[model samples]
Target: MLEKNHILTPEKWVKLHADYLYNYTISRINNHEISKDLVQETFFAALNAMKNFEGKASERTWLIAILKRKIIDYYRKINSIKGKAEVRMNFYDDGEHAGEWIEERVPSSWVSEVEKDIENRELGNALEKCISALPEKYEIVFRMKTIEELETEEICKELDISSSNLWVIIHRARLQLRKCMEDNWFKK
Candidate 1:
């Protein structure tokens, strides 16, 4: 059902949609060069598939759909079993409070204050460091599940693991993060 009402203007895409598309891709991919490549790939794919456009959605929406597939494809390529190697464990250094959160009480909410802002920034940095310290597969699984907010089923499919296996990985990843936070973030 290709309606004549919606026509894609490929020539105007760069001027009109480039920034929006780049922002979308960067937010998900987080690498400047890779995001640019993905955006260009999206445009090329859209151009090649222009004939298949059904005109049910706006041009921007259609472009985003193609971009989403490109992102998923990128993840699938990186997480493929052929290239995967045995991951080494880099758990946080052993200490008395191993695998524990040392906070007396969790703050109910962050107030707008300079001290709070500094603390929040430090906490975020510590957490980011701990995440990167995780083993390769654990880091990838944790990021996809928590940061990207992808559905469990989608993550499992992309990682080519069973649902149960995905959960176990997530659980172990959380434990690793907790231990790291205890050593670095909570201690400070």
Candidate 2:
């Protein structure tokens, strides 16, 4: 049961949405090449799933939903690969003790001092710098869970990661941020 008014042709969709979708994606991803690929992929996926289109939402909304999922999938894939590499790099030679913070990498406590200086504008700037310095995967997860206030289950579902993995990533991200803030803001 298709609605004649809502049925969209591919050419019409491309003409109407191609630039908008590209701009939307590029704004979020900050990459022209990847945004182009994702937009193209979105069109192909929408084309294939046209039969299931319920026509409840606008065509642009439906396509954007698919594109959003594609972007999340891309991030998930990157985090999975980086997670494996992180394990290898951070572990000892025995391989039995992975995911443990090394003695040298252990961060000192700065929470008390940070609390005292919470109103300092420099502290906020330093925090932003630290967050931006994190690897893309960790930064995304940290921002989503901490800054965006997204739930653990929501983050896990969006990133396609396990609960344990999410915890590990968050822990590492926090540690890195703490170390960064201590070095850049607390000491200075």
- Estimated TM-score per prediction? 0.65, 0.66
Compose the digit string of candidate 1's lDDT tens values, residues 1-188. 75556779999999988889998766555668988998999999999999999888899999988887887787667656543443323433359756454453232343345355456776788878988786656666788889989899887765566888778778768767766766665544
Compare the candidates by TM-score and give the number of the best one: 2
What TM-score should be assigned to candidate 2? Answer: 0.66
**How large is the C-alpha RMSD of every model relative to the true structure?**
7.4, 4.7
Name the regions of candidate 2 deviating beyond 4 angstroms: 1-44, 47-52, 80-101, 109-113
For all candidates, the clash counts are: 0, 0
In candidate 1, stretches whose alpha carbon ends up further than 4 angstroms from where it belongs are 1-4, 81-119, 133-141, 148-162
Assess the local accuracy of residue 161 in candidate 2 as a C-alpha lDDT between 0 and 100: 80
Task: Determine the backbone clash count of candidate 1.
Answer: 0
